[model samples]
Target chain A: MRTARNIGYILGLPVLLVLVWWLSTLGSVNFFVPKPADLVETFGEVWFGDRFFSDVLPSLGRLVVGVAVAILIGVVGGVLIGSVRWLRALLEPTLEFFRAIPPPVLVPVLMLLMGITDSMKVMVIISGCVWPVLLNTIEGVRAVDPVLSDSAHTYGISGWARVRYLVLPSASPQIMAGVRQSLSLGLILMVISEMFASSSGLGFTIVQFQRSFAIPEMWSGIVVLGLLGVAMSFIFQWAERNILRWYHGQKEVENAA
Target chain B: MSPGTLAAGGAAPPKERQRRKAGKGAAKQLLGILGIIGFLATWELIPRLGLIDERFLPPASEVIAALVVDFGLTAFWVAVGETMKAWFLGLLMAVAAAVLLGFIIGSSDFLRKATNSTIEFLRPIPSVALIPLAVLLFGVKIESSLLLIVYASFWQVLIQVLYGVADVDMVANNTAKTYGLGRMARIRYVVFPTALPYLMTGVRLAAAVALVLAITAELVIGSPGLGREIALAQSGGAISGMYALVLATGLIGVLINMLMRQIEKRILGWHSSIRSEVIV
Candidate 1:
């Protein structure tokens, strides 16, 4: 009963929002922003049609490939620099410097050099996503309690074993947080890159629809993208909770203590 | 929490700490300088050796020369001035609106709970994706760019403020209330100051996002800015010119970030994260 009440409470806000959306567009208001029902119909058309799968698949493929590559590179590089005090000192500022430069600023030059290809889009996503993961991994490594390290050292665990057994688990939660952030950033850049060029993808579809003044279709694209963002975030949160149950349990223990 | 506790935490031997300190000092300085030198040398030597196309990869010397020579150009300065104007204006509005809204939502538990899902739903929608809508409404103008910047920045800062306020220590709030403080007074004296670190972090994050959106607006709209300059230089076949501008823009971004950090440190000197030595 309590769970049902909580679920109802959770669902209440979106219902209110949808109601508002319906009310606002019932009269002859701004026509550009289509009604919620219209958007739903358009969404149905796209989802049931071939146009949706082709666009979504390529975008999802790019997103998975881009984020995976970024994670591998960022984690490896971050671990190296972070574990070695000397390397961390040397590379930290440079990393921070590039991290600050708006990734989109690099997009035009990338287009010039690479010319609107899959490789260029992948490169953009990698560069954008890598920084947060790398920085967070470094912070996570640094944040490991020295007492734990000392305890491990007492047991003669050093080198790779130390990292795998002690450091990695300790840092996993923070690193996952960074990965979540990177995923969102990668998604943003993926769409932007496509919006800048591509002949397909949801972003391209939106642009194409907007250009043709297919307002309903354009609204549908925007609504779908927004929903995709929310859905992916929910998925990531669920994964995090599942994978980091230990971390959550630890928190509960700390609170009890 | 106490001085005695903190002193006990630092109970490691001085000699070992001294050695670590010296090692850290040397490494930090060496790496920082080495990083700049390595990048400069790569830029200078790589193109000069004809490995990459000179036109596309312009040597460091030529890039530096462009910065110096083109510094006086009306067009370049205009672009910089215009972009900065939009960024600052949009950032100001975002900060103001976000703080106001954040305060309202943060203060009321029921309302905050009611709106929580709505906020979360809107927050994840990449502000950049709204570019089509923005263009449709306002055309390719500064107004559209500024609106997007404000939109993006508001979500970030508002959320930060919300979390910051929510995370305020319960004991601290109760103590203030025990002193007979009213709602506004309690908030002003206790909540805002406690949230300063979070607020600063939000501003810092917003700064980076604002720069991205500002450049993106220029890229998409073909307006005048560093992004426009790069686009123009690329399209005009002035590859070297494009490279030079890109380097300059990168340097400018670095400088802004460093400056913001410096200011954050100065203003929040009492914050442990700013004043205390790093853990590693």
Candidate 2:
């Protein structure tokens, strides 16, 4: 019964929102304010149709590739820098400067060099998303247990095996936290990059529809993207849970203590 | 000044060691400067040497010259001021909404559970995805940028604030109740202090997100700001000017980040996180 009530609350707000949105547009509001039903219909037409293949797929592909590249490079770079005093000191200011710049600012520059290509979009996503992950990984690496390191050293675990088995796992939680932040950033940059270029993507489609006064279609695109964002976030959370199961156990013990 | 200083402070034990480390720190600072110099040199050389086409990306020297000219211009300053205004206003609005809503929702277990899914649903909706709606409603105005900025930053703060509020100890709450403390008194004394550190983290993150959206809105919606100026420069084929404007926005970002960090430190100085700061 309690679960049912909880579930109802979880579902009620969105249902009410959708209903209110539909009702508001029923009585002839502004043309731009699309009805919920109309948005649903349009969403179906654009997304389930062939348009999805060209626009959504490529966008998703870029997001996946960009995020993967960023995580790989960011983690490696972060570990290296975090483990080294001289390197961290030398690169701190430079990293901070680049990280400070909004990722979109780099889009036009990338466009100039790479043109309106998939690589440009991916590069923008990578540049924007890498900083959070890199910075967080550095903190995580530095924060690893000194006792754990000493124990590993005493057991004759010195190099690659030590880092692979212990250090990476110790830092995984912080790295995951950084990855979560970077996920949203990567998504935003994906949209912004596509918007800037008037190229092929969900963002470009939405802006194109809007520019032409295809209001319902534009609203549909927004809805689809929002759903996409929510879904991606859920996947990230689920993955984090699975990968950081041991970390979660440690956290629970800490909390209990 | 950053959280990274924790590692640094632990190593400075003796005066002689500290002095030696200071010398090494100076060398490290020099190395950082040299690294940047090397980067600029590469940027300058790459284009001028015809390794990369000059028309696509002008030399770093030209960009620096353009930045100098931009510093002298009133319009550039106006654009920067416009961006800053949007950033501050949007961030302020986000912080207000997040704190109020966070406390209300977090105060009740039922409300928190009920709103959990709703918040999750709304939180991940990329604010940039709302650009079409913003442009439709405001149409290339400052409000368009504000809409994006507020929407994006609100989630950053709201989630953090909620986490903070939820961190209040149950034991402390029971103790307050046993002492016959009023609801308001309990919240004021117990919840507020516990939530403050999280609030600072939220605000810091929100500040950065807000700046990103402000620039993005201007660039995408053709609003009045440095972002718009960059777009204008790009379209007008003033490559050097465009780079300079982008650099200007980046410099502003660096400043905003530094300012936010300082503010966070000042506001949360009583909190353990800030109190734990060690000077090397």
Candidate 3:
């Protein structure tokens, strides 16, 4: 009985919500909200069919490549500036100013510079996604334990060796946190860039569907985007867990206190 | 906004540059100043140097000139006001709804359980994905922006508020219960204070998110704002004007971040995070 009630608590509202939606849109509201059944059918149709290669794959490719580039640049640059005091101060304000510019605005500027190309879209993603990673990296790297660094220094571990052994591991948690933040930003930007200046991609397809009044198809596009977000988050979390296994272990031990 | 609280949280490593200002070598300080000047010069000279087309890559001086001229135009101020109007209203509504729902849902185990799977499902849906839906419902009006902004920022605050309400001290709550405090009174005297810090952090984050959605919505939906202006200028081949509008939005972003930090400092003064802000 207790287990049944717990199950009810977990599933109750969501089931109720779907029921209400289905009931309300049974006939009349179908024009506005297309039925749940229709949505699922369309979801399968678009995602599993030819639209997969034309729309979905290109968007995913740009997103993955953009985020990967951002992470690489952000981590390396962040470490350089973060470890060196003067470099951070000199560059900090400039970085902040650039980060302050909304990522979408850069789309127009990038279009002017590079035209409506994949490189432009990728650039928009990079500018938008890079900051959080960069800022967090700097914060994470700088926040590394001074005692450990000082020990390394005293032990004659200098320059590259000191950073490789002493710094990166300590800063990994914060760096991962930054990456998590950027993943969502990257998704937002991926759609925006396509919407603003592209011929294809998930965002353009959604707009195209809407413009043609293909309401069901538009809804399907949104569903695909949602699944993409969920997938990215799942992958990120798994990577984060594995990457920071020791950190989590220590955290659990601390929590037990 | 991501950096605002993180920078202020005092968990940051020492900003040795500020600390050693006087005792620091003069050469290092000079290089820093030179770096910024060199960057500005490069911006001014990049197109003038003929590396890029002048028509497309107008010099920094031209952009600055456009910015100065825009200051003299009523349209620029009106655009700024409209953008801020949407941002503040969306942020206010999201906060109100999130706090009310967070409290109601968080305090009840059944409600919390019931909503858990649904929130997880809904939270990660990028707000940009809703642009087409928003336009379909509201057309190219301010309402489109409001819908996207509220939906996106709502999750930020709601999640934080949920965490905050959950963080209510068990001992403090038990003490209230022993004193025969009623449910509302317990929430007021115990839960509210514990949750205020989390709420502020959420608001800081949502402010930035709200601005982002507002701009994106305007840019795509063709609403009246700086974003729309930027799009117009870019398409019309008003390159300097587009850059100026972009710069304007950047200034607004910086201002919003600074304002949020100020508000957080004032409100969270008694909190440990704010307490340590003095040393930084």
Candidate 4:
């Protein structure tokens, strides 16, 4: 019964949003704010077959590689710092300083230092995505009760064994949270780097299409990107729930389902 | 006091001296500065030695010169001003909207639950990806940039605000209710104050996002902004000029961050995070 009411409530904004979008784009509205119908038409036409897949596929490939590399680096580095208090103290300020510097702004520097290759794009994305995961991992590890550590010690569970059994399990939820944060950041960097300077990828495809006044195609690229973003996030969330089922505080989100 | 008398203070002296120990601290600070300088010096040396292409990767000296000479150009500052205006305005709008909407959405359990999925869906879409759509609709105008900034900043701030609002202690609210406070009064005195810390976090995040979007929008559409200047420099193959603009942008980021930190510290003096945290 409540489900119907919730559905109605959720549908209200999108419905009104579409109506207003349609009305504004009627005759005198801005060309930029195209109607929902027009957008649908454009979506159908440009996002149909090879044109859609070809443009989007490369960007997705880059995002996957870049994000995967970032996770590996971030998680490893985080564990190192988290397990050792001295290392954490030594590195935390430096990491915070770098994190404060905007990642997109590094395009010029990266291009100069590394060239505008796949490496540059991947490196830039890694730079942005690494911080959240690393920081969160530190926090996650820190949050584990020392009593648990002492208990593990008493059992003679030492070194990596202790970390794997006690720290990792307890920190899994927070680490996953960090991963979720990094995923979006990675995508943003991917698109922005491509948009900033590239000859291919969805970002480059959109910019090139726009330069030639291919408005519908440009719009199609954006919609695809948006949908891709939505899809990836959903996938990550589902994966998190599956992997971190022991997480105790997510009842509210599960209740929604 | 004599040296022996000074030593008689015992524990405090040793503890204070240990805290102020310059031995490792001096070396660490020296290493950090040396690392940056070493990096730049190597880059400059590499290009000078013809090991790297100067056209693509100019020497540090050349970049500094370009920055000095070109800093006076009208186009440069005009672009900076335009981007700053959009960024500032968008940040203000985002803060206002996120605060209001976040409060509304977070205050009710039903709305929060229903909207959680929707928020998650919107969260992942990179705002930069919306540039093409924005340009198509707004036509390389200021509105396009502003809209992009708002879009990028909004979700970040909104999420932060939501978390902030959620963090408000229920026990405190129940206490307020027990004292017979009404909904509005309870909200004004209890909810808003508790949420302020979170709101500040959101605003800081939004500021960062706003800067990114503002610059990125200019880059995409050739709009007047620092990013546009950098783009122009890059395409013109003025490598030094590009470096200079990059440095300028970095400096701007540093300045913005420092300014915001001061403001946050002053305004949120009572907050534990600001007061208790140390850099190390």
Candidate 5:
């Protein structure tokens, strides 16, 4: 009975919202707002075919690549800067300045340098997604317990082994947090990059549909984008759970105490 | 949602270290200045040395020169004004709506529970996804920018406010109740103070998101702003001018962030986090 109530609490409002939307739009001739049923039908028709391969997949692929590169660069660079006080001090101000610049503004700059290409879009994503991960990793590395490092040093664990065995594990939790932020940011940049001077991709296709007054198709495209976001977040959570299992268990123990 | 934590994380290194390393602080500042100069020198040299195409990547001096010229132009100021107008209005609307709704929903357990799933579902939908909808609704007007900015920043602030409200001290609340304080009185005295820090953090993150969306809507939708100017400069082959406008946007972003941080510090002066930071 409690489980049923919980489910109701979770799903009730969304169901009610859908019902309201359906009821209100029934037989309505609104140009912008499509009937819920029509949108569902259009969503499947528009996305579950050739467009999926050509536009959706490519967009997802770019996001994956961009985020992957960002994580690699962010983690590597962050670890270096975080471990070195002078280097961190030297780079922090510059990194902060770049982070302040809205990433979308770089779309034009990248477009100018790289032309209308996938690399440009990926670059745009990297430019935006790198900051959070980089900054957070630096903080995480710096925040590593002094005792742990002291013991590691006493054991003669230095160089790459120290970073791999000691620093990386300690910093994994914060790195994951940064990665999560980057994933969403990467998705945003992916869409924005596509929206500018693009011939194909989900963003372009949506804008194309809107410009051509295919209102239902445009709405359907947005639903796909939303679903993509939900799916990416789910995937990240799953990966995070696996990667940071020890961290979570430790956190739980600490909280319980 | 995470940007607040992100900012805090960036600022989190213990201040006591700075005091201890008083001599090192000056060296750090000098190194930071050197770092910027080194970066600028690298930028200036790459094109001049013919390592990269000068047209594609103009010298830093030329871009700065162009930026200076832009500072003198009324049209540039007008674009900046438009972008700021969208950002300010959208941020204000989003913060107001989020605060009001957050309190209403956060105060009631059943309401919070019911809305949780819906909010989660809606929040992940990137505001840029609604560009089509915004354009369809308002065309290329500032409303397009406003719609995107408000939608994007609303979720940022709303989620923070919800968390803030939830964080109200149970002991303080019950004490207020025991003292025969009315709901309004308790909320005004107890809940508002507790939530102010969270709200400030929300507003800070929202400000960044608002600027991003404002620029985006202008860039993509052909609205009147610096973003559109950048696009025009790009298409018109004014490479240095384009870079200059981009630099201006960066400067504005830095200023907005600094302004938000100052506001947060001032408003949250009595909060433990700020107090600890100050004491350190």
Candidate 6:
């Protein structure tokens, strides 16, 4: 009974919002605001066919590659900088300056250098997604327990073994946090890059529909994008749970105490 | 932007350690300056040596020269003003709405529960996805930029505010209640103090998000701003000018970040985080 009430509390507002939207748009002659029924129909026709394969899949593919490459670079670079005192100080200002620049502004710069290619879109994603992960990783590694480091040092653990056994495991929680931020950033960059210049992709299609005054189609495209954001977050959470099981378990023990 | 908080929250070595390292701090600063100089020298060399196409990537000196020239231009300042206007107005609106609504919703268990799923559903919808809708409604104006900026930044602030409200100390709240403090008085005295640090963090994050969205709206929607200027320069084949504008945008971003940090420091001076940092 309590579970049922909790579910009602959770779902009630969303249902009411949708109902309000439906009722307000009922019999409306406004061209921009499509009826909920029409939106549902258009969503099915627009995304459930060739466009899904041609546009959505490619966008997702680019997002995945871009985010993967970003994580690889960010983690490696962050580990290097975090472990070194002088290097971190030397490079810190430059990294902060670059992070300040909005990644969307780089779309034109990348386009100029790399042309209107898939690589440019990937670069756009990497540029934005790298920073949070990189910064967080550095912080995480820096904050590693001194006791653990001393133990490892006394045991003569150094080089790759020390990094693998001691550093990465300790920093995994923060690294995972950075990865979570990167995923959303990657999605945003993917759309922006495609919107700026692309023949095919989710962003391009949505812009195309807008230009053609296909309002319903445009709205449906947005719905798909929103769904994609939700789906990516869900996947990230699942992966994070597996990857950070020890971290979570430790946290739970600490909390219980 | 969230890194700001993480850096602050991370462990700070004790006072004696900091005092001992004081001499090294100057050396570190010098190294940082040298690093920037080295970076600029490399950028200057790359195009000069034809390592990359100079047309696509102008020499660092040329871009810097163009940026200097841009600083003197009335048109450039006008563009900056337009972008700043949108950013300021959008940030103001988002923070006001988020703080007000966050407090009201967070104060009530039923309201918080009811809105939780709805906010979760809506929050991840990237504001850029609303570009089409904004265009349809406002059509190549600052309002279009404002809509995007507000939508993007509102969530950043709202979520932070929600967390802040939830963090109120139950003991402190009850103590205030026993003192015959009314709801408004209790909120003003207890909840406000607890939430201010989180709110500051939220504002800082929102400020960054607002600037990004402002530029994006202008770049994509053709609204009048530095972003539009960059797009104009790009299409006009003024590659050097485009790079200059891009550098200008980067400078603005850096300045805004510094300003936000300053503001956060000033407003949150009495907060434990700030006090601890000072003591260290």
Candidate closest to the true structure, highest lDDT: 6
Candidate 2 local lDDT, A19-90, one digit each (tens): 887787788877768777777788898789888898999999999999999999999999999888777877
lDDT of 3 by residue, B31-112 (tens): 6677767677898999998999899888888999999999999999999888999999999999999999999999998789
Q: How well does chain A score by TM in each candidate?
A: 0.93, 0.96, 0.93, 0.89, 0.97, 0.96
lDDT per residue, candidate 1, B1-280, as tens digits?
A: 7544664578676558779889978878888889877877887998899987776677888878877776878888888887888788888899899888888888888768877878888988777678778778888778888977898888889999998888788998999999999999988988898888888888888887787788777777655587778778878988767777776667777877887788788888887887564333
Indicate the residue-level lDDT of A83 in model 1: 87
* Residue pairs in candidate 4 whose N, alpha carbon or C atoms collide under 3 angstroms: A32-B137
Give the candidates in order of lDDT, highest first.
Answer: 6, 5, 2, 3, 1, 4
Better of 2 and 6 by TM-score: 6
Q: Using DockQ as the measure, which candidate wins?
A: 6
* Superior candidate under lDDT, 2 versus 3: 2
Let me know the DockQ for model 5: 0.76
Count of backbone clashes, every candidate in sequence: 1, 0, 0, 1, 0, 0
| Per-residue lDDT value at A241 in model 3 | 91
Order of quality (DockQ): 6, 5, 2, 1, 3, 4
Considering just chain B, what TM-score does every model have?
A: 0.87, 0.92, 0.88, 0.88, 0.92, 0.93
Model 2: interface root-mean-square deviation in Å: 1.3
TM agreement with the true structure for every prediction: 0.91, 0.93, 0.93, 0.80, 0.94, 0.95
| Candidate-wise lDDT, in order | 0.81, 0.89, 0.89, 0.79, 0.91, 0.92
Ranking by TM-score: 6, 5, 2, 3, 1, 4
Report lDDT (Cα) of residue A154, candidate 6: 100
Q: Looking at model 3 chain A, report the run of 10 residues with the lowest lDDT sum.
A: A24-33
Tens digits of per-residue lDDT, candidate 4, A1-257, equal 98888777687666666688677778866645556777788888776768657767777888888888888887778877888866665566556556655667677668767878988988888877887788888888878888998899899998889878888888888788889878877888888888777887877877887778777667777778889889888899789878887665476678667
Model 1 captures what fraction of native contacts?
0.60
Docking class of 3: medium
lDDT of 1 by residue, A171-225 (tens): 8887898898788788778888888778888778888888888888887887777
10 residues in a row with least lDDT, candidate 4 chain B: B271-280
Model 3: runs farther than 4 Å from truth?
Answer: A1-10, B1-35
